[model samples]
Target: MSSQYRTGSRGSAKAKVIALVGAGALLLTGCTAEAKRGWLPNVERDTTNHTGAIQDLWVHSWIAVIIIGVMTWGLMLWCVVAYRRRKTDTGYPRQLSYNLPLEIFYTAIPLVLVLVFFSFNNTVEKSINAPVDSEVVVDVRAKQWSWDFNYNYEGQKKYFAGEQAHLNTDGSAGVEETLPTLYLPAGKSVTLELNSRDVIHSFWVPAFLQKLDMIPGKTNYIYLTPQVEGTYAGKCAELCGEYHSEMLFNVEVVNDAEFKAQLAKMEDGHIGEEYDRQPNKVNSVVVEHGHEEGGK
Candidate 1:
């Protein structure tokens, strides 16, 4: 018996050591919390309002998870350990059913929980739906397989054509995925005006926790605020075309000085209107070629 006890203790000690070593290794490798959210990438707390609300929801969700997990495990353990088939109660037992108060207790508790869930959901919705007064208004245009941005600062909307940058078309200029990536200033609310030319598309930024639909012939708006200074990526959440996956944009949150510097260089004009002053060179050449072909 003494020898058996010694062997069991040794095995338990080795197991504990292995567990600790594994935990230490994970921490050293920075593999823990691989699925954790932005708080770690940033040690200081987030100051943005949207992130705060999201954090609150996240905390509440975790609370709900723990509450449910404990209740399930504790109830199961109590039933098995305390209410087992004991020798004292080995004989047949009285059957019982139809406890109204217990039934009400179960039903009412869950109903209250559901009500809480709805309440939190509504709060999140309200936070998202409010009018964003300080946000930068960006007009988005969706074409064959690329995205374009038209920044409307006040009444002057400057179009960032992705014709030369690979971020958008074949090798066109990159679309602002999150818009103003590192170029947008902080503490300002941005209202994105979304539209599509051919098919339906959706813009989504997970970090900002907001999404908007891009419908043809109509425009949609969404509000976003970046609380922290870091790079956040956005993607076309809705399927629009063959190269839907290629549709990407970036949001750059920058300081005030940097933002103003970039904003100063913006210039927007109507290309069609510009042609009215003088016909397009390509169009003029095409017309001349047509006339020559007819004469021949």
Candidate 2:
């Protein structure tokens, strides 16, 4: 009878523990409702055509991370407290060696997690990389410490070019210098063909949440549709040479009329002759001493 009573007590303890764990899990699940409502903080703000979809994936992934973390820590704490070496414990605990089911479970869960993440990420990546029927095609050239943006408009057999950002003459990097502006029409898709004159560089605009590497011999393409209308700063994300930090540029998202106006101004500027020259088959312009010459 005493043995039966001890077994019942053990069963009761297990039931109590399971009930507590379930309650805690339910509480956590309730908290995750906030995540469903989009309460995650670390996610970047959605400003472009791609940022919203990216944020959705980011939030969901973080939600999974939080749940896994809570459950893992909860189990660890329960084990530490429930199996601690108490003074009343006389001999060693059970001599059990291994738990095959637990091991298989741990292994299987990570595999399943990786598969799910890969699947979702693959879908999003494909969506983002899909071809764009662009209304504007811009040629981007990255050199040692600067960037040049060129736009080829319809019916204009020439390409309009914008210069690189120059550092302030005051010797104080504290003051912001005038950076070349990349003008884009709002709600229009634009395709950029990127190339590098020297080393590798990354074109990154934080608001766009998209970046592409510029290779010296290869031309890369990036498509983006800006949803918001504003001026955003851009820079080279890659660590190039000594003045890499000064490779700053600005992107101006404006109305269609304004974009055309900017293009017209670029074509009528003093360097319009240089802009009229087209690059040969390579679609890359030549640069000497930070000045862009006609394409080879």
Candidate 3:
């Protein structure tokens, strides 16, 4: 009877292992194409030149984490079952004061993992932020609840000063015609110089899979080549004030002809101006008040 019970326990454990493996495989296969690639839904695999590298790093990192999790859980379960107290035992199981090798392994493994992640991230970041002889440069200025885009191409510059978004009754931002739109020529390298007039804001475009902070009195830049021609949504990722949620913009990646025509139209409309223009007074007052109170 004892031998039969032991055999049955082993079989049950094997069955459980098989079932878990089967379930994991099913879930993996059931994932959508995008989810299978990077575990993200509704996101394209590659929207810019740097997006592929970003997605690769993201997916591989998750894979490494999942592998480590499975191994750790398996070891924990083994410890629980293999070292379990038995009915025939008298006293407690032998206890070790320390495990030098195990301790060293746990420490070294995490350090190695961290180093690996950092190395990959640093490589990708350097590639993305590498300076290029860009065909176009955009000076982006962020204010209380709007954006200003100055497009510089060839010998001409075009500007667009965005207005604050319309707020719905529920306090959510509404899509309005007044929102600023930035146009870029597809397949051309462009650099965006980011700055803030009031407080810190983060320029984020989900499709680009990149975001940079706009710091007051400091300039940040991002360089990218738009590979696809389409309209993409952009917003401030940082919470600056009450209207932070209303800070929004649009990016239109069009062909060279369309980009040139848009620039001409902007020039005709006098939509934007030089960076030397005065900052928004309404937001400036708010910032000034905060500074005065802080000084007090």
Can you give the lDDT of residue 226 in candidate 2?
Answer: 78
lDDT of 2: 0.73
* Number of the top TM-score candidate: 3
User: What lDDT would each prediction earn against the true structure?
Assistant: 0.62, 0.73, 0.80
| Candidate 2 regions with alpha-carbon error over 4 angstroms | 1-46, 90-92, 157-177, 268-296
User: What does candidate 2's lDDT look like per residue over 1-296, in tens digits?
Assistant: 69999999999999999999999987676466334544553223545688888787878998888998999999999999988999988888888788999999999999998999999989988898898878888877776666666686674423444344456687555323467667788888888888776678899886676788987778888887877788887899999878788887888899889988877776531222243224362344456434444321
| Per-prediction CA RMSD (Å) | 9.7, 12.4, 8.7
**Better model by TM-score, 2 or 3?**
3
Identify the runs in model 1 with alpha carbons over 4 angstroms from their true place.
Answer: 1-47, 87-93, 163-183, 264-267, 270-296
Q: How high is each candidate's TM-score?
A: 0.65, 0.72, 0.78
Writing each residue's lDDT as its tens digit, candidate 1 over 18-65 gives 999999976666644443443332222364557667667767887796
Evaluate candidate 1 by giving its C-alpha RMSD to the native, one decimal. Answer: 9.7
lDDT of 3 by residue, 45-90 (tens): 6678888888888888888899999999999999999988889999
Of candidate 2, the 10-residue stretch with the lowest lDDT total is 268-277
Pairs that clash in candidate 3 = 159-272
Residue 261 lDDT, candidate 1, scale 0-100: 70
